[model samples]
Target: MLVGNRVILVTGAARGIGQATAVFLAASGAQVIIHGRSEESMDETVRLIQSAEGLEPLRVAYDVRDEAGMKLAFKQIKKIFGRLDGLVNNAGIMTEGLMGMVKTTHIQEMLDVNVTSVILHMQLSSRLMLKNKQGSIVNVSSIIGTRGSEGSAAYAASKAAVIGATLSASKEWAGKGVRVNAVAPGFIETDLTAHYMENKKEKLLETIKMNRFGHVEEVASVISFLLSDMSSYITGQVIGVDGGMVI
Candidate 1:
């Protein structure tokens, strides 16, 4: 799918699926704005896009949980790009813990980073998009959010909340020319899932219908499609990039 020079912002673009998405979108011709916790963290992503001969991407760094930083980042987008055409809410943290042993602090942190920040970014993005009367939003949720997992209760909860927001926001914005959707990815081979892969690779492989973990580019391609006109008539849906793990 072609993004055709659309200005898009990808959060947590320093690594993993987020980084891959930024690179993929740039390759697809989208003018990407890559965000990370710090500018240094996004170096590799920047290099990858540049190496691919993609347009120079705007780099913005700030913790997703920082409200002021988030607002300022959007402001920068407006000042530089004049308008935002798409957003990928991919910045999030995964904290694994079982029921009773899970730390309250950890749960709260997940909520702030995964759920709250997503909502806020959508709000900010929609405002800019609405100004032009068009935009698309793609949220990166997790399969654990839809099907649940043994030790990822908090992370699941936060991701599930993202699904909820995606649905609600889609309904609220679709009539105004903006669309919102989510992708629930199953175990993906990324730094984020390295621990799980190391400890439960065999069992997880047996559970996956494809008998393998997903690749970052696989998820990135889906995110790009969602942000492009190829998915023009789609919204409020959570597409599973799970290799049939959810089924």
Candidate 2:
């Protein structure tokens, strides 16, 4: 419910679910650290948060795939905020391709950005959280990771890896007061998913029990809940934000 005064970091906060989550968390009173590939990309997100009269957010720009950049970003957070209370691993890339036809470059990029970076960030963030003996982390996954889709084999593999990491990390740090969980969204209407919405809207709708694609705010709300005390007892679980698509 409330994350007031908590210091949180949201990666890929320039757009889509990441942007929405950063805005929502800022509005809810968290001191949000907005991260993007470049400071210019975060302008709109920063503007929206400021317009809401939320706390002034800290801005960090770095490629999630770059280890040195990520380390520097964390160091900046530590120097500025003194402690990290929450982390949302919302930065990821999804490149769709069928198994045999998928480009090797696409697969590697997905693994590096979606899976590798997530684990590294988790590692860095958990250390900061452990010092405080309490913290929360939320990773953005997708339904495709759980139930494979036709043209997303490699993408699915990357997200599936996230789910696995969340489970393992939760167990590793739960006793030390760090909680890790993931949100597996279905058909969310974000820029990343615009292609599917444009090409297969009706067909995708038929599969979801709710008969609708989700909105960015819908997923953001769940991420906020996971970061707050409302989900204090929840960890190591992959909460589906899908419209009953998997069922």
Candidate 3:
């Protein structure tokens, strides 16, 4: 109940880690907002949350890279919730290819989704959060961002940028009671990573010290902690849910 009555928005929440986070946040008593690129996706997420006895999270849709869409989404948020207490910038995309072989458009798309959209969300969300003079934000980063990986150059760069943004935002807003941090997940089992699980299953397992892929709930728990008062003193940190891969 740490987040009871708190208004929290989770983007890219139609499925996968985003959906798990939304469910956890709602279960923790937040007035959760579920966002996705389509209504069908958000609807499914809402059903899942409701089935779990969690609050019926608001369903919002937006193209992460579109500034206008984000603005309108926030407008709707204010109208419904009146204030924003927490935000999870979990919306992102991954395009795998060799650094040299990756097209310019592909890299740009990755940056636009994983990095630029995050900044835009922070800007729009922070304005509402700052009004209350207290808020928390959790950016979903990736292990690739810190350690690098084959065929993930652009994705790595984008996630790395997320860490940098989290750091800077924490410093810039901490004094005003806003905390920003990030969770760097490693080899999570989600639709996004289904291809990897299929194509590089054993090799990926070998790399994980835990000898297993992470569950979305594991990462979601950490995110909930970071967004709650439990981690009030923590900010500008990139905590890895990577099963000791870094070790």
Candidate 4:
């Protein structure tokens, strides 16, 4: 019960790590705002979380990149919860190809979804958190953000930006008592990575020292720690839940 009375907003909460984190937080007694792009997916996640013995999180649907829609959703959040204690920026997209071969639109879309939206959400959420003098912001970065990988320049770049943002924001807001941190997860067995590792299993395994893909719960546990008082003195840090891959 790390988040006994907190209100949290998790983006991309329909499935994969986002869904897992929402359930993890809810089970710990957080009032979670399960956000996703589709209403059906959000509803399913709500049901799944409740069935798992977690609290019934509020289902909210909004594309992270939709500024107008995001603003409206925030207004609704203020009206409903009156306050927010944490935020998990888990919504992201990957665009992979030779850097030069990637189209302009592809690059822009990835940047908008993965980088720009995160900054916007942090800015908005920070305003709400500042009032309380206590809040946690966890941005889901990737191990690739620190290590350059072939054919994933855009994705890596966006994640790298997330790390940069986390560090800067954490420092700037530390005095105000709002902790900002990032979780750089390694290759995890989730739907997002299925497309990349479908047939390149051997190559992916060769890169990891553990030689095994990580589970969603492994990442969620670290996130829960960050959101809890257990990590009171930690901020501006990138906790890599990567099975010792980059250590």
Give the alpha carbon lDDT tens digit for every residue of 1-247 in model 4: 4687799999999988998999899888888998899889887678777887777788778888899999988888899988889999999998788978988898899999999999999998987899989899999999989887888888889999999999999999999989999999998988888877456867777778988989998998889889988888999999998887752
Query: What Cα-based lDDT does every candidate model obtain?
Result: 0.93, 0.94, 0.90, 0.89
Clashing pairs in model 3, backbone N/Cα/C closer than 3 A? none
List of clashing residue pairs for candidate 1: none
Residue 87, model 4, lDDT: 94
- Candidate 1 accuracy as lDDT: 0.93
lDDT of 1 by residue, 1-247 (tens): 7697999999999999999999999988889999999989999999999988889999999988889999999999999989999999999998887898899999999999999999999999988999898999999999999999998889989999999999999999989999999999998999887876455788888789988889999999999999999999999999999998943
The per-residue C-alpha lDDT of model 3 at residue 70 equals 88
What TM-score fits each model? 0.98, 0.98, 0.97, 0.96
Residues 123-225, model 3: lDDT tens digits: 9998998888989999999999998998889999999999999999999998999999999999889999887646578777878888888999999999999
Find the number of clashing residue pairs for candidate 3: 0
Error of 2 at 181 (Å): 0.6
Sequence-dependent TM-score of model 4: 0.96
**Per-residue C-alpha lDDT of model 2 across residues 1-247, encoded as one tens digit per residue:** 7799999999999999999999999999999999999999999999999987889999999999999999999999999988999999999998887788999999999999999999999999988999999999999989999888998999999999999999999999989999999999998988897776445788788899998889999999999999999999999999999989953
TM-score comparison, 2 vs 3, better candidate: 2
